[model samples]
Target: MDVDFGGADDILFERSGHAGIVTLNRPAALNAVNHRMVRALTRALAAWEADAAVRLVVIRAEGRAFSAGGDILDIYEAGRAGDPPFDFFADEYRLNAAIARFPKPYVALINGIVMGGGVGVSFHGSHRVMTGNAVFAMPEVGIGFFPDVGGSHFLSRLPGGFGLYLALTGNRIRHGDACAFGLATHSVPADDLPALLRRLCETGDADASLAVDARAVAAETEDAVMDAIARHFAHDTLDGVLGSLAADGGEWANAMHATLMARSPTSLRVTFRQIRTGATLTMDDCMRMEFRILSRMLVGHDFYEGIRAAIIDKKSTPHWRPAALDAVAQADVDAYFAPPAGGDLSLQ
Candidate 1:
């Protein structure tokens, strides 16, 4: 059944037999999440979790992209109005945590362009299924923000140094790479998804029907290219990572270098520290850290400018504050991760 929150159709929730489905409905902006969607989703999930009739929760989107990300336009407006950026982040993180620890089985159908907040909602699922066209990344660094929404938790868990690499470079991973990188559980052809989902809905034992041999799935789809990801992404700093890639002297290495070079240097540095610090953090600590950084960003970091240049203005050339990775100071990066003046995030 569909639920309405005011006039905004930000989220659509429906139930079919034992299956409860949540759809991100903002197709025009690639289903990019805004505040209303987050709140509606949280409410819907709470309802479904309490409903014994609902055995499974499937999250999908109505657009070509699963979700482009959190609504930067809202963030931009907040920054413009001089409101605390943490306000949005705190609420969003709460929703993210709810999804992560939700009692019922939650599945995410990652069809296309899953990134940033999309990852927050979809990646924590009990079963994350991707289509061949699905593209995934935590490219917050490109926009002068750290990967929030429990990215710290998952990014740190990525095998070897993959977490550090993706955090710094904002590289996009295809469905095959996503499965190999542990970001997704299954990779079925995009065309087969409708039937698979239909079968899932039709099953009497939804949980058992959705379950697949995790080991077999991993072995079959593990990305062979991850060795390169581990080796090249092992460096502590972006400079070192780039140098390693450059030294490798291959088409992939060259392409990766160009991609990294295009992102904001300040963002890259902050992202590096975010991943490193997040490596040892519990999920709670990571969320708290992200809140602190995001709060600071709302006041007047480069996030507004980055979004203006990249998304709104569509210039694609962001004039970062430091303009180069080496220009960002260690102390500045440390400050971003520091706790807010009062205390850590309040779970309640």
Candidate 2:
């Protein structure tokens, strides 16, 4: 058992009244999840699930941002040192699944940059509260990876094809937009989060802890801009999306077209298929597929090149193998869905 929870506090856990609280604590790293953190969190959550005294779990972070994602530098270094980076995703995905199926109230006070692995943990909670400082995105495509962490399952279900648009563009989700997209169930002011946490810990009730008066968030994703988005991103195929955007002469369309062009061609194609297929599958199913895809990505060229450009070298320019979307063959994308080298995730 990796239950030496006291020895690992990168993800801090505590009992407050009838509530179980977990705080992501690596402020300097923006609480980016590492392998130990994942293990610590999974153990804590499982323990909380077995403890009848706990009626709710509160997930928050102590820093400027909730979490940037999983530790990318760790993956890059592991590859450099010729070590396999497998346990992090395997455990992280298990934690994600645990969050999704948690029986008690799971509250997330997301009050900062929340992206990638951050979304994996927070979005699956029963109540996702976006604060004034909250910002969200799934930027996997830019790094030659598709949106994992149960994104394919939930993002595919958002209103008006907004989910697909986000998956493709890697755009930021901010403020009221979080509520509008149903990504957040409540919006609270950042300054009031401390008091809210107090109330939640005291009462172990999400509703009793949250109110709309000073914390209301209102956003409009319905605009002329969305019309163009709906027209282009609604296509089931990445090529179809590109074709529509390429034909449209609108300035916004042109910019978005260019945005798609900049992403990893393989990532985009695989993600396009990922979200569409994920819509028909369960969360666990989506995770299994993601595990398969990520296992393949680890051994591929673009993942390493992406890590080099985006994190290691700080160049922000990745030379994708299949540089253009048209260059990606169906067989190439299909291979990502094959059985993982480590076998399927052992969630049990």
Candidate 3:
């Protein structure tokens, strides 16, 4: 049975059997999330939660990329026009928190790129089903942004300081690595996703249906690099991490140093503190913290500058303010964690 729910054309909301389905339909834009898409998803999830007919929820995308990220171009345009678009972040963060606390089995069928906001909706769910082609990352630092969308919570919890390394470096990981790190719950082939979705919808039994096509991901011996990450990134300050890397003077260390140098110095410091603080907070608290960071980021100099260099100008040469990491004052970094004029996110 199909339920007719009105939403933006880029996103489809329907019900089939015991499952409520959300299909991201904007393939050309790579399913980039917008304010309308976020609102519709939040509404659909709320309605499904209250409806006895829908026992489970499945979120999947129609494009090659699950979702590259939020509609950053929109944000950039608004910021340039003197309107910071805090509404979008509020709604998106609320949606992330809702997914985290969703009562039913929330399954995300990921077969392509999943990063930034895409990770928010899917990773917080009870079931994160990924295919061989699926890639995961939180590349916000490159754009002078901290990894929001509940990244503070999830990233802080990943074992062995892998989360901080990913945050600072903006690295992408394949399905195998994601599964090994517990970021992905199940591994299914891309070709079998449709069948698996059908089984989930028909039966509303995630464990049983997933077991049919899913396999435990074997830990790669190469993942022993987590030990190195823990050693380099476990420091209390960004300078400490940089100092450790500089002292090593090795190939990998030098590469990481160069990568950090290319990113916004402010973003690197903010993300470092965000991850550490989130380790002590709850999911909802983490969202609130991210909201604070977002308020500051939208009004700051680097985010728009980063957008100009990377997206608008395509130059990939962002001249970040206070270009050096040492110039990012600890007080300025603390300001990002402070409450905004609108107050913190009220997740009730």
Cα lDDT, model 2, residue 8: 67
Scored against the true structure, residue 211 in model 3 reaches a CA lDDT of: 89
Worst 10 residues of 1 by lDDT: 212-221
Q: How many backbone clashes does candidate 3 have?
A: 0
**TM-score of every candidate:** 0.89, 0.95, 0.97
> On residues 32-123, what C-alpha lDDT tens digit does candidate 1 reach at each position?
88887887787788788898888888888987999999989988877788675565677789888888888877888888899998898898
Which of 1 and 3 is the better model by lDDT?
Answer: 3
Best by lDDT: 3
CA lDDT, every model vs. true structure: 0.78, 0.85, 0.90
**Local distance difference test, candidate 3:** 0.90
Ranking by lDDT: 3, 2, 1
Q: Write the per-residue lDDT of candidate 2 for residues 63-123, one digit (tens) a residue.
A: 9999999888888888777775877888888889889999989999898999999898899
lDDT of 3 by residue, 1-348 (tens): 555455569789888888999998888988888888888899899899999989999999997999888889999999999999999999999999999999999999998999998888789999999898898999999988889999999888888778899899999888887888788999999999989989998999999999899976765537546677889998888889999988988888899888998999999999999999999999999999999999999999999998899999996799899898879998999999999988898876
- Better candidate by TM-score, 1 or 2: 2
For candidate 3, what is the TM-score? 0.97
Prediction RMSDs, each to the true structure: 2.9, 2.3, 1.3
TM-score of model number 2: 0.95
